[model samples]
Target: MDVVEFLSQRIAEDEAAARNLLNDRSVSESGKWYERRVLLECEAKKRLIGIVESARQAALAAMVRHPEGDTPWIPEAIEWTTLSLNALALPYVDHPDFERRWLGT
Candidate 1:
């Protein structure tokens, strides 16, 4: 398979993993465990995975409708992805690169 299909399958697998971690009911004291750094990362990954799935669906729909080339939906998806990334990192406001990369402040 080409790179896009490979990447798409990988994303689906990762999304499944993230969702399973988030939805797991077997973990006792979920409140305490969820706050751990790794679990926090898993939460963020779950949120981003939704965005990735949506973008992939949009791209597939666009390709079906107009197979000539990439659709205009891509740029919109990219913008949403950027916003999601920034929101995910909001707690890291004090980072040195935060101002330059995000706010231009």
Candidate 2:
């Protein structure tokens, strides 16, 4: 598959994994043992995921309605996805590899 198709598949997989983790918060808690603060952070991540999903759906609908290229919806969907991914990584900002992994520093 092309890069775009590969990337799309990866994103779908990542979103699915995030949803699974959100559903099974107990597994994560057992691994890291987060307190109330982290629980709230998880909730925020869940909301971000929802936002990303909504943006993706909107983009897909737009693509279907207007097959003629050059639409702003694609970029808007990308922006939402990037912002949500960044927010998802915020809880790990203090990690040693955060800058290298997430920020590409």
Top TM-score: which candidate number? 2
TM-score of 2: 0.45
TM-score of 1: 0.38
Among residues 3 or more apart in sequence or in different chains, the pairs in candidate 2 whose N, CA or C atoms overlap within 3 Å are: none
| Alpha-carbon runs more than 4 Å astray in model 2 | 1-34, 90-105
Instruction: Show how many residue pairs clash in every candidate, following the order shown.
Output: 0, 0
In candidate 1, stretches whose alpha carbon ends up further than 4 angstroms from where it belongs are: 1-42, 46-70
Error of 2 at 52 (Å): 1.9
Query: What TM-score fits each model?
Result: 0.38, 0.45
What tens-digit string does per-residue lDDT give for candidate 2 at 5-88?
Answer: 333444454556655665774766654343334455546556666667777778878877888866866877866666556545
- Model 2: residue 29 alpha-carbon error in angstroms: 17
